[model samples]
Target: MTKHNNLQSISVRIAVKTPAVSRALEEIVSTLDGFEQQLDEKATQTDVLVLEVGDNPAKEFETVRALLEDGVVNQVFLTSAKTTTDILLPALRTGAKQFFQQPLVFQEVQQAFVDIHKERIAGEGIAVEKVSIKPGKMVSVLGAKGGVGTTTVAVNLAVSLNRLYPEKTIALVDMNRVLGEVTVFLDLQTEFNWDELVKNISRLDPAYLAKALIQSAPGLYVMPAPNSIESGSQVSSQVMKQVLETTKNSFDFVIVDAGTQVGASAFRIFSSSDTIALITTLSLPCIINVKRLLGTMRLLGSIPMNNINIIANRFEKKSAISLEDTEKMTGHSVYSTLPNDYQKTLEAINTGKPLVDVAKNSQLVKSLNKLAESLIVKEEPVVKRKSWFW
Candidate 1:
């Protein structure tokens, strides 16, 4: 079933004075599963209110504005047949989320209501988390340049770690936004993505978050990036921080495919990460970019030199620019190197399986396993806290 199949209950009231518009609004609201139109206009509190501006729009606007400021209405949708800047500007000033100018588009109206329902469901999902928790470490995999095998490293490393510690829960999040290919790489279809999680951030707890993530392996879960470019814009660094914080508290480890993004979001990830695996290739141009990226990170001062681990991806022993040259340029020692196995790596990606899953004995998979092993810090057994009442 689709996520929007079961819409939660929402009380709607129409204050449209236009007979035709009111009937249209009523008809549309009735068709929606969870939206119930209230006949009693005297009711002060409602989940949603559709208001139409008439000859005296000023009075109606003031009433709705007051209703919003006083918390009498959660959402106010404005509709009017007359397209006037005077009406549109005031409607927006009142904090209306949507404005439908006469001859309402059916699809737009339905989509707006669906969005409201999703938000309400998300809000209601918020509750006190009663589960015991152990905070996990976050490993952010970032590419020095495009096509530097960031997702490859992240996906395989996550699978390798899950294979090593079958009991531990691992979350692989695609933070590359719309361009993310983690899901494609893993060949997993998910009902939810980062955008959905961010929308329901207030409801984030172990159970809610678990529902949003799709399990790929026995102990590995994946969260893909938003599907559309427009959806990607809705994600903010603050929301990402909250999501990551909640995720880390629930899982044993989080592997983020950050995909060469440098911005507030990237900085936030770097700041919160236990390890920042900077992926680079054994080439002149890519190494130069890596050096610049390292310099930029140092200038920002959000990431420490020790926390940043530069892993040289697609390394060849006969390459002109060796690991030593890379170290000399970046001023940071190479954390680890994965052998250049182009054919095998491409085959694994094409098959939508991690290297460990497809070719368990390959040198690339072995190197990834070693990297995962070094990242695994043995934690002491979690002790349950006794209640004061006990």
Candidate 2:
């Protein structure tokens, strides 16, 4: 219960159902100069609707949902004697922005008022104008299935880009949602993850994002996914969209390690990215899954065929399946093939070092550097180099 500074110029119109809650809100609103209160339950034009739930919280939640669906209220705040997760989760899913326990913490109420006031001011175009950002390109690396070297490609590509273009800002995001290993791959220890940022998504700005990022290298910032599986479900597609949009504005290049699962959030990331790198191996099971993934991407229609780059990982000079056969089977051309250097690759991962840093002269490292060069924008050339990987 921390008191927020009074917002003087902004006005809020609040309606309450319970008399005790009404008195508490009135006392809190009196602390601010321009805040208004409407006690009538029938009031239709109110900024916020404060509903107090009794014994039957489920029935009360239905009423809140109906008001939201009918557009009768812009925001909803709930108060109940029972503040358990069972009660709070439904209220949030039904569109309640904030919740308060009984007897009312005045500081929490005041902070909610402050947040709504800022939102109102933003809606009316009176707040500080958003900084015009020259957005960078976003690349999402998605694997067809597990253990397809998705994280390897994502980490190396990010490091290569950072080394190639020393002046430009680059960020790598681990969007695996559940059990992401980008931080582990890079051996980066971060105090915060994407979960913390999405929880306070409305407060997302460049300054806030800068603090959330962990600088794994000189110019490369890594935003790892949550360690716990439960935290992954907390992030929604809407939150993912906001996070990527903000990241695009802040960096010169953004790489997303979208893990194998193509859920709603991953789909949103794929739709928004400038490039979608589909990584797969040369096995029948992996090839079949690649075809299915390609069909799904076609159905989504957000990522064009040309923008989807099909990469073959752990490729060999003499394998059962050739690149031509892979292209024919998947119905997509292979963009590039990473060499099957198992021992070198394993050593790089075990030591938590990028390919370029540990084995700079290896064929696998050369292929990764070539892939990184292909991703760079021609107009913003770091150096005039020839393409040899193609």
Candidate 3:
């Protein structure tokens, strides 16, 4: 009962104009338990109600005014196909918090709604959290047939974030069972492998975790694959979930360096990740593989139907295929691409250090910085940038 009164200070009412918009909003906000409500709004008193009137920017403006004029509504979100200045500007000026585009990704919407709710409650002196990523980012950096810099990108992303947010606990996981290169990349001799931890996973505790793990850098813990163990010796899917859950309690962001191979264990690990960074190139075969992987994941309930974004690694702008056709062929829009800086990426890998550590401003680093920033802030659609198709 005390918790109930305590939570009224953070109570939020989400309002939608059309049924379609209401349905879309539900896809994300349905998980929020406390005092979150979805109402067919009639311009009445409400706090932090999202007012989304799609396509009609004029109506969106009136809705915002209606919300602003009332003392009840604290924050308003306008979802429209028109995200341009002319349409989004007025809404922004009206103190609207976010401008959501059509065909909304639920993750993005979920973030915005959480932000508004937190702000509304926090303004009233109740504590609130702004953006909460689901504990860890399950980022798979699959090389496009082994030449692309997949592992390099994954390692650097993890290391860079550990450096960027030094206060927060970060983990680097090498999910490649047999020949994981993350151990080599960091120059850390393997003291323990993933197999040892999972072997005694049923008795997993803080002390057990301490013994089974290693620390090579500040604020960074590593879960390296076995030095002598093979894939068949790996822990089962149930054990994998247990390991990740325990890791989440100890770490804020878990960066997985899973190699590009669709195996039972790889699929098992990815099923628990918050974001699956599918690294591929603009080549037909790789892109086709991405399509196949996307379908396979969807079939197995591993990848969320809407969350998978195609990342074009080592992509160049002068390739045979345009980015548009690549998007069309894969049926998933490219999230962002890294420059085809083979030499720079190779140097970083050979040296066993993050590109951000050695070269902060390289084209590859610049692109990764953008990628990490987007993931940390967790705004979508993951910032689709252009590059040459390789």
Which of the numbered candidates is closest to the native, going by highest lDDT? 1
Name the runs in model 3 displaced over 4 angstroms. 1-137, 229-234, 377-390
lDDT tens per residue, model 2, 1-390: 222244434333444567887788878877864456765556555667777777788888898888888877777877777756577546655667766767777766776776677666666566454535567789999999999999999999999998988777888999887789888888887657788678768757654565467788777899989879999787789888999998887788899999897888888898888898899999999999999989998998887878889999999979899999998998999999999988888888898899887889999999998998896666754332211000
lDDT values for all models: 0.81, 0.79, 0.66
lDDT (Cα, 0-100) at 270 in candidate 3: 72
Residue pairs with backbone overlap in model 1? none
Q: In model 1, where do residues sit more than 4 Å from their true spots?
A: 1-132, 379-390
Of 1 and 2, the candidate ahead on lDDT is: 1
lDDT of 3 by residue, 1-390 (tens): 113255553334655666776787765665654445635456456556666655666776876777677766766666765555566446545656565666666766665555555544666686544433344445555554564556777888888777776766677777766577887887776557667667666556433454345676877778888776464354686787677766654566677777776777667677777777788878888877888887788889856856565678878889998789888887888888888877777777788877876778787888887787666645522221110000
Candidate 1 per-residue lDDT, tens place, 1-390, comes to 023444556899888888888888888888887678877867878989888878888888888888899999998888888765567656655666667868877766776787687666667674323446567879999999999999999998899888887767789999997578999999987546778767666656554465467779777899888878788776889989989988888777889999999889889988999999999998988899889988999999878878989999998899999899999998989999999989889999999978876778988889999998886665674232221000
Best-fitting candidate, scored by TM-score: 2
Listed in order, each prediction's TM-score against the native is 0.65, 0.66, 0.60
At residue 62, what lDDT does model 1 achieve?
Answer: 89
TM-score of 3: 0.60
